[model samples]
Target: MEFTDHPTGKRLAALSLAALGVVFGDIGTSPLYALRECFHGEYGIAVTPENVLGVLSLIFWSLMLIVSFKYLTMVLRADHDGEGGVLALTTLVKPRKENMTRGAWFLVILGLFAACLLYGDGMITPAISVLSAVEGLGHITPLFKPYILHITLAILISLFLLQRHGTAKVGTLFGPVILIWMASLALIGLHQVVRTPSVLAAVLPWHGLHFLIANKLHGFVVLGAVFLVATGAEAIYADLGHFGRRPIRLTWFLVALPALLLNYFGQGAHLLSTPQDAFHPFYAIVPRWAIIPMVILATMATIVASQAVITGAFSLTSQAVQLGYLPRLRVTHTSASHKGQIYVAPVNWLLMVCTVGLVLGFRTSSRLAAAYGVAVTASMLVTATLFYIVMRKRWEWKLPVAAGLTALFFTVDFSFFAANMTKITHGAWFPLVIALLVLVVMLTWERGGEILAERARGLTKPLDEFLKGIADDPPKRVPGQAVFLTRSHNTVPVAMIQNLRHNKVLHSEVYFLNIRTEQIPRVPNFEKIELERFGSGIHRIIAHFGYMEEPTVALIFTLCRDKGVNVDMNTASFFLGREKLTIGTPPAMARWRSSLYLFLSRNGMDPAAFFDIPSEQVIEVGARLQI
Candidate 1:
């Protein structure tokens, strides 16, 4: 499937709207709670005119500098090929030295953690976005307040259940629904802006500066809530693969940004006239007749935002598996034409359980707000750190220029992260804990795999020496071909060796195939396969792929055919080795980690299934691996 990274004409127009539905959905829904959280959440500031304008000013500039300039302009340029995100960034930026230095390893760790925190963002987004939207009922009547939790749980459960179906059929509605949602924000806010024209003064940068000074420490802390408006800014960079820079930038500048600012100013205008509405400023500005309809529209918008984050998680996990940060899991591609549209059942079920637990535990969007910004800000800060290196090491920019730009991004991000850090005791620990858990699992899998591979490589005999031994001894050759999958190209596969030792027979044609996922996103078809004949009936095959791609048995055969090596797929049998891991003294890690890796290895998808080999034609040989 080919994607027009740079689309023009109707393609661009369609994608721009599609970007609104997916890319901007989370940030777009911020109007539901961003302002109200400033004065209504656990940290309630007084709703005085000075404070109102001050918070408004912060929201405006944060969106401009952070979302508009930093992400859309700066970070998007650091994409791996056309892919963006911290994981993708890890592939693009390299160490100056051939060997990864300590500093380079630290940056890699930062990227992995950033990727982990994004999972936190993914989980929290649905809980808060949908809850905030559903909270609109409280304003309608005190009578409906009792049902909010039940109603939210229903919506969330329904959302996760629908994930298996893919969004392709209902995706068309996303653009139109969000279009109305955006238009409503602008139209609704435009009316209030006209009424209290004084609110327009919030756009000036000085009011934000003054508010910080007047409030002192209090104002600084206010950043935690104010940062909520920019919660989904990372999604723009994350979703660059779906809608490229032009459409996302164009939509933000033209549609989503304007509507957000207008609505926010309108909320400020209404609050100035009625400070009592600070508790729910967003819905307060709505006319009585329009409130119910607005809630319906807002609910739809949040659902889409939640769906986008969930799908993004699936994509991220797929990348992690290919990159060896995780054990392979079953990934279901839901869309026939789109490779990116994937569904992972374990991920879906796990997220559903956690997100539902969040609603039950937090009980309200305002409380969940306590947990939102910390993960997101931490992620953004990590991304900025990696982006700095890309500009310096990858792009070859002047040292001072790289340092200056990085510092600038750090200043803004650090402010938010520091502020969010203060809320750790107040529920922000939820995402941090999640991030830590994910980090341990990811690091353990990677480190454990390295040790296992090293040990396996040491045990393997050279292909030439093994072939000569077989040629000299002449093990009885059988009919048809046999393929052995190996982790290392230079070493003989364990399955083949075990087969020879036990069965004492060889196939007429033998293939020692090794598939390695490179740090890059996609290996070109021309450079994918490396085949060498070893003078007997043995062939060595090495296939390379990027983390973003999946390898298939058919592709390997096709590449072999192109390289003048004929393959008889119908007559070939593939052999896979399943490791039964045992814990050795120290075991390359702690006992706990060894057990975890073993569990993952045991439960992981079979290679035959993961690589698209025919199940009937595949045989599994189990070997004990003491780590």
Candidate 2:
């Protein structure tokens, strides 16, 4: 169901609560480490009263300007058919190749790279978030310090292993757990703020301005740590389709923003009085009697955060596959009611191994924090760049207004990005490497599909010519029906031609079906199919689906029936082409990329399985292709 379908007050409230678990988990949990990092991390400064106020001012204004203004107010409005994300935003500006100008192509690449960066961010978020929560055990007692790494690996492994069981059952508890978590943040933080009301002075911009001037380069370097506060701001936009703009905006204003501000200021207040607690400010705010319970709650909150990121990766992979940027992977739907709750095994396991490796390698959240902000800041920069294009081109805003807002966003994004760049040698290079590798794969798959389509067009005859030739020959007509799946709408399918050549007989009814993934999020049922008759019981049916949808044979047939065309499932056969790709002498792509593309092609999910066709009635026609 679309978020717009439910506009009732009760339903909106319910959705906003659910959004808290899924949308705000990452950002909510930032209080666990953000304040601590600014004073005790790799580039941390002294935790005097002035420094406390300065860092708090930076955190407060960052959240207000970047998360509040840029994302919730501006970026959230740029949804593509109710879907907000880099991919959705990319399609809005550059929907089709025919419409793509040089500038559009550059934006598209930036968007794809932004998507790749998320994968890297996805890996680090789980490791660092969970590790930070688990490290609270160290505060409980020094004894747990020796076993923090082992404990973190266990939780991460269990989390990934549990993905196969689906989150339908566990998801019910997410809302309540996170609600309590946010409340705790506010309560504990408010307690400290009451004790040290002087911390409120940081609300003014001058303290942060003075901090930067006094510290100079060191203060600028601290932005890498300050950027952590809003690292999950993108999640607010990414999950826009799930909860809609109204609920997300409402939740942020009423619940998330207030609670976050309270907690951050509370931490600042606590630091002003007890500077030595900078190493563990978040936990220090908790009462001694409540430390164990708080740790448990924090761990749950982090798991919820990690779950959101993992699910996002799966959704992103699905979108990439449908949009033809990646080869098809096995997608298992875990919920009948929610099409978005899907699990991709390859993605799940790969993430687990990498996350566990990160925990093992870094061994502490402080170290992992060094590797975190680089990719996220880069992604935010891309989002800001695309948002600028969206403003000028899609929204058609006046040049001065669009440029002014975008320039402000770019100033913030680039500053954070530049600050994080200094961390490359300190392990920030890991996500960059991962993003580059994934970008190569995506670009290779995209380019390879174009080359293959060009070659296929060269090999196949036009549909009209094929039909005319068949009419003249008058091939023997057989009983029942045949369905041939093809990529091109104008050209004849290789499988249909092969069947006609070998079997020497035509079916009574023939369907040349082509499935197209459109740039939107979801296409309505009435607008899905275009049917045309080619005489002699031959027809061409082009099925249109959106990037967020899965096209199935049964659904297509049902739509066809509505259009006055019927085929008995028991008597129908589905024909598919299985292409064997080989490197041509000249090579259509770089040698390594061609090899990578070939490997991906060979291992991709079978067409029959991908389209939900019955395996017993499927026939594969093999063909060889060079390039």
lDDT by residue for model 2 (1-627), tens: 288564558998889899999999999999999988899999999998888899999998999999999999999999898999888888887857777788778889889998888888789999999999999999899999999888888899999999987898899888888999999999999999999898999999999999888999999999999999999999899999999988899889999999999999999998888899999999999999999999999999999999999999999999999999999998899887877789999989888988999988998999999888999989899998888888988879999999999899989999999999989999999999988988889999999999998887776789999999998998999888999999999999888888888898898899999999998999999999999998999999999999999999999999999999997776699999888889998899888889999999888998999999999999998777888
Per-residue lDDT of 206-318 in model 1, one digit per residue for the tens? 99999999998888888999999999888899888777888988999999999999999999999999999888989988999999999999999999999889999999999
Highest TM-score among the candidates is held by which one?
Answer: 2
Which lDDT value does model 1 have at 325? 84
| Candidate 2: regions farther than 4 A off | none
lDDT of 1 at 615: 90
